[model samples]
Target: MPYEPLPDLATLSLAEIAALNDARKLPPVAQWNPQTSGDSLMTIRADGRWFHDGGEIRRPAMIRAFAGLLRREGDGRYWLVTPVEKQSIKVEDAAFIATDVAAQDGALAFKLNTDEIIVAGPDHPLVARGTAELPAIYLAVRNGCEARINRSTWLQLVELADADLTAASQGVRFALVPA
Candidate 1:
């Protein structure tokens, strides 16, 4: 499928963003828990690159397809799940990376490495971690997965923040600096 570019994020209203998110139908991996489980030998590097048996998976379509099947279980494990089986996947850091960001209609819209757009709100909150000197910010994605906010995107958020280093989205205020 051809990837369609979204209209300028800054031009979208909060309701439009919500509607875009609501229209996406993800695979029901949560409902399809099979008894069969095994290692997929797939590793997601800390920088958000996908590799299988030490070989890079270069195709964006394949990566997006595999990303759609990802699930994080109660045991803090990542898996590529299907109705018939589940394959364990190793993740060095976050499963996704927030590659781009925009301040839209009093909300922050994020574009992930997989080209998925999400708005930060109660369901997808921004969390600050790491030390004050080396702060790491993360955004909660679906299925218990998170997207590490990359440096450039983080800077973009900073530019959008108030003097207190906080930003508001969907009536929720988020701290950019780790407490």
Candidate 2:
């Protein structure tokens, strides 16, 4: 599906902001406690794309909705949980892609493929994962979920970091670290 950027939240009405946030919020999957009945017929690709059965899930909004419903159990397993049922889903790597970034006053914020936004702060730490030679950078999403930072975004982040250097950031090397 063709993509359109989300409208600026600052310009939106209070009701509009509430509506957008409500749509992004998923049901309490963690508290549902549904029996693990079956595996989800879905796989998240290494490049942060999702597929079901076989074909790609091309709708960003649909993908965003599903992402909100995803959960990770204590045993390092993934599931899509609703009030009625819980089902497993395969993740080749991370489940999300950090597609866009914005920087303000030395702080970095990200926009996901699903249109959700997060700042790379305490709750949303940015780190590089994967091998040293070819790292997969990530920004934390809600819970324990981490979104893979794409190459272009990573480059932009580097540029921002360089441009907004501070004494604390001086010599604070940002390198590929395990996620």
TM-score of each prediction: 0.93, 0.76
Residues 64-169 of candidate 1 have per-residue lDDT tens digits of 8899999998899999999999999999999999998988777789989987788899999999999777889999999989999999999999999999999998
**Cα-based RMSD of the predictions, in order?**
1.5, 5.1
Superposed by TM-score, candidate 2 places the C-alpha of residue 37 at a distance from the truth, in angstroms, of 2.5
- Candidate 1, lDDT over the whole model: 0.90
Per-residue lDDT tens digits of candidate 2, residues 1-179?
Answer: 45556775334544453466565546776687886569889998878788999999998777877898888777777888888888888988787888877653444556677787666666566676677567677777764677888889777666665443211121233443343
Off by over 4 Å in 1: 5-8
How many residue pairs clash in each candidate at the backbone level?
0, 0
List the lowest-lDDT window of 10 residues for candidate 2. 164-173
What local lDDT score does residue 154 receive in model 1, on the 0 to 100 scale? Answer: 94
lDDT of 2: 0.70
Q: By TM-score, how accurate is candidate 2?
A: 0.76
